[model samples]
Target: MRRIVNITILLYVLFGVSMYIYFFTGSDIGIPVEYKGTSADPTTFMNARELVLSEEYSSVKNFLFFLGTPFEWIVLFLFMVLGVSSKFEQWAKAITSKRFVQFFIYFFYFSISMFLLIFPFRFVSYQLSKAYHISVQSFSSWMKDMTIDFWVNFIMMFVAMHVLLLLMKKSKRRWWIYAWCMTVPLTLFLTFVQPVLLDPLYHEFRPLQNKQLEERILEMAEKADIPANHVYEVNMSEKTTALNAYVTGIGSNSRIVLWDTTLEKLGENEVLFIMAHEMAHYVKKHIYWGIGLGLGVSLVGFFVVYKLVSFIQRRFGKMMRVEGKGSFAVIPLLLLLFSLFSFVISPFTNYVSRYEERQADTYAIEMTKDNESAVKAFQTLAKTGLNEVDPPMLVKIFRHTHPAIVERILFLESYDGKIDR
Candidate 1:
């Protein structure tokens, strides 16, 4: 029975590694190119922009994205089957009989596994950035950044996991109630505090120092009916050359973060357009909508896991390998299964996100009254991010968070007249 468990673990690890290698190596992934002159074919240029901005490559990336769902399902199915077996039940009974021992074993294993997986990826990703000449920081600097990030996230995860365990013990319907209660608060905290508290751990943040630009942004915010205090800038140039920006938080705490790299690369008009787009998200209340959608999806995922686990236990209770009864070692296995189920729903989530992004883009056009800057900003962003010029369609559906750049440009071009503020 122990050997069988070991075999299962080995197989799972191998499968994961295989998938990673296949996706990382098989895709013709490369950094975005600098945009050249009018001599470039318009259709080709647009396609290239779309590919870069969308981060799509050949069909390989899309295939891997799609493949994630089934792979997760397989893992979940195996866990469900193994968890309910007589042998696993016995093991669970023993572990639950000593709660401290059970907790320590699972917690330690989880922590170690997460660290091993995440830390190396951080190092490798940094190396890749350096190789591409996109990195702005040295290895030592990157390591310092990683250390700060690790501690912040590690502490948060520790607190959250313990809280979840507490909730799991108290709830009558463990998965559903836990999911519902945790989702709202977790989403809110991550959206709000993450930018203000967590982000500063990795990069320095300062107020927008360009008084003229700042004033213009505030004016735009007032015109757009978004609060002025939410606009700020972060010194992201110390970390990487990749241009980026985001809107986060909610209500009074909500704010816009403009990467210094973006501010440096884009003209004032382009920056204003980007700021307008972010403000649109806040004014339109997309943050709250997104959180609500996330909660709903999480609830559905929890229910699916609960039902599936129950079914497995009922169907094959005697065959399970574990010794004892009513063990909760099965919980992690259930989580693994749920993760797989959630991956299946990722496309829907991406679609919803893309829709919200499009709305924000429209708002930017209206506010800026200049589709040209918006187009230029996207092109510049693509170049900064080393985006592929044209990714396959399947890649777009599975992986893209925003509409392809070409699609966005075409949409803007379709406007019949000057956009009204």
Candidate 2:
């Protein structure tokens, strides 16, 4: 068992190192020849310094993206293999006789431990954003946000795990199915409350201050047949220079949000194009489709986890000090397995996300009939975010949710509107 753990760690480390060298050590990739002299060229929009920064930033971000899952898997696996999880379980049991109370205690310590273990990576990521001039937040403000995030995640996980434990006690083999069933309501609740309750915790949100712009957005919404009465603007200027807009939530909780930076940086037509893109997500029902797909994937994932847990128990139960399927000590192992599964399935999920994004883009242009603004919007988005127009194929497969910036721009440049209207 010790040998196997050592091998797993070594393999993951090797994989990360090899991929980094292969992906990042090459000369900065240039725009393809087909786009070299065209408006779609990244060089046309971004200056030389900006281009260099984008490449450097993209390399680091993509490396970290590939490194993240393996590092998490390693930490979770170590907690189980090195007896840390059992120690946490024992400490929790020592303080209380009530099962739920014990679990809360155990999970609190475990979650903190995992957070600290992973904190360095998070710190590096934050520092990277600052170094690239993408984040304007101070350390104190960032830490405050982090603390809120920690507590929010803690409460949510505590409730979920408590339910899992109850289900486990009822039927060890079928607990995953029961837990899966519970996710539908949980997803709905979070979606319904997140924009109102959770989002306001980090940043202030208000009605779009520009009445004319708001009216125009509402008119676009009306044309899309969306029921939204107001456009929301988030105060992101204090936090970052990045520009963004998105449609979030379900039912009446649903709304379109734009970062104030997006409003300040882009022309009115560009902003409307972006807004139309977001509304297209709602109009096309991508939100519902995403939720359904996630639930479907989770259903399969839970079943696989069930089978894997049984196998782990039969093979290395004593070595890991986790004797039963239902024991709290098994939490780390379960997490490790889930991390591995998520890593394996990410490419597929990303593909679906990219497809949805493409559909939204097409709808945005058709609804607005403003191809020039659409092109400008994509270019500005890439510039502000320090995004490479053409990332490496591997990075696109795993990291990109939308079509490549170059692709989006070129598509907008070539699109012709229907003349009959």
Candidate 3:
């Protein structure tokens, strides 16, 4: 068992370090010569200092991003291997007779332990963003936000894990199928409520103060056959310099939310083009499709997890102090397995995301018929966020949800704007 743990740790470290060196070591490779003088050019959009800062930021961000999963896996594995998870479980059981109370108590300990163990990586990442002026939030504000994040995540995880364990206890052999069934509606419920209930906790949202832009956005929504009555603006400038806009929620709860930074940075038509892109997601039902794809993956994922977990329990249950298939101490092992599975499947999920984003971009161009504004919108996003307009292929595979900025801009530049009627 020690040999297995040691070997796993070594493999994780080697893979994480090697990938960081391979993809994020040097300066961004940059776009082709044809884009050099164009608005899409990174060199022209940002000064040399900003360019260097972007590279440094990307390297650190990618390092943290890539290492995060492995670190969590190791932590969870160690908790199980070192008997810490069993200790936590024992401690919780000693405190309560009620199973639900015991579960919550154990979960709180597990969640906080993991949070503290993983916090330094997050702190370093946040500090670097602040140092590079990417994040303008003060340390106090950041801490507050972190606290909010912790509680929100804790509550959500508590609910999900409680249900999962309940299902496991009821049907040890069929728990994964039962859990997957529960997960589908839970996911949809979160998506439906997030824009209204959760989002307002982090940022102040209001009707777009610029009534004219709001009117125009509503008009666009009307033209797109969307039921939106208002366009919302979030004060993201308070936290970061990043520009963003998106569609969120479903049915009556649906909203078009623009970051204040986007409104401040771009022109009316550029904003309109961005809005059109967001609206495309609604018109095309990308959110529902994304949910379907995710649930479909989760169905398969849960089954794989069930098989792997059962194999682990049969092989090493005594070593980990996991009593049986129904033991709550097994949660750490379940988490470790799920984390590994998510990392393995991320490339496929991101590929689908990129495809959807490209579709939205095309839809935006067709609806607005203003290729210049579309190009400038992407260019502005790249400059404001210090985004890599043309990242390496590996980064695109794992990290990128949208097409590279340069690709979007070049597409817009070359578009003939003949709408398909």
Candidate 4:
């Protein structure tokens, strides 16, 4: 009864605190409490020069990301405002007849235009990685991979825009509704197809070769109620020194993948803990949860676009020559709004992802019963990945999909799973 009473009091406190934080953050001039920004300051810590360097590096990277992401959207919007979309529209008229083909033409250039705008920043990030000795791939190899990525993006964008335009043409009132409905199955299908069809375009994969480790992995998978069919290794060492592992795809395409760097660098027990974490992701059915959540978010985003886009187009449409919903050029306006909405909504998305990651971390610690190994694996990961042990709170709220490495290790150290030995 005492324990129950204490728990009730604790719950009330937590609820009150959460409400306070939400209210504090929900307004136009709401506190940017997360941006206090001193957590990553090197002067704050003792003993570890590595942590200082890592945090400094992360700060630069984060700044680059902040500058680059919004810059693209701003540039695209500026082009439309400056009447570049009209010029592109004339080119599309000269080139193609089928509405689908015309959209493909517009988006091919549209996608590449964004890519070109962002490429210099990406290259700078690449140079930073090389300076840090994290990335190992040569410029030629990187360009090759990026070229493939470009084509893939172009195709995906074309199909998505074509379909969206079709939906709008048929029912402007209900297009967002139809588009929101389509997101669920499409996301699932891509998740199913990615491991089998798409992953090979970037990396080499093979069945994990160490028979002893493979046996242990299979045993762990069985214990975790996973399929235990395959453990695949990706040659990530060819690109970067980062140690990583993940369970990706679903159903037939579901597989556990380990980076070759992870295999080379981590011990067998550490590998098992990591694999257990990946298995936890599958067992939790986080993919379907993500799909459902994304569908809902997409629905909300589409509704917002539906409500506000026409007003925007009407006010600026004649100047840009992008009149009406059926105009192929409407795609750019849609993307602009979607990008802004995504930026605005990022904190909520990151919150859910971080929750799922923490759940998987707890499940991993319990399933492995090797708290030391799990902690050690995360330590190795943090070191290899150059993760900031204590990132800025704004980074956590806005961009981080997982909890900080320090918090993860601390949680493992304090966890009391107490499963029978």
Question: Best candidate per lDDT, number?
Answer: 2
TM-scores vs. true structure, each candidate: 0.76, 0.96, 0.95, 0.86
User: For candidate 1, lDDT tens digit of each residue in 1-421?
Assistant: 5676677667766876765655555554432343233212133444655544345333333444454444444444454455532334355346676764555455545444445544544565566666565677887887787667666765665565555555545663674566567677778878878766777777677778888899899998888777666467888787688787888777666778898889899999999889988988888889889888988888888788767756655665445422123354454455566677766787899999999998898888877888778778877765666554344445566678888765676566555455452
Which stretches of model 1 miss by more than 4 angstroms? Answer: 1-105, 118-122, 163-175, 313-328, 417-421
What is the per-residue lDDT of model 4 for residues 194-248, given as tens digits with 9 covering 90 to 100?
9988999999999999988999989988887787687999999989998989888
Q: Which regions in candidate 3 have their CA more than 4 angstroms from the true location?
A: 1-5, 24-28, 33-35, 418-421
* Candidate 2 lDDT over residue span 168-217, tens digit each: 77997788999999999999899888899999999999999999999999
lDDT of each: 0.66, 0.87, 0.87, 0.78
lDDT of 3 by residue, 1-421 (tens): 7897899889997988786776566445678888788877888678998787777677677778778867888899889888898888899999989989998999999999999999999999898888888899999999999999999999988988888888888898999999999888889998999999999988899999999999998899899999888899999898999999999998778888999999999999999999999999999999999999999999989999999988878887898776575678988988888878887898999989988998898888888999888888887887778788888776788889888888888788787755332
lDDT value for candidate 1? Answer: 0.66
- Deviation (Å) of 192 in candidate 2: 1.1
Clashing pairs in 3: none
For candidate 4, the lDDT comes to 0.78
Name the TM-score of candidate 1: 0.76
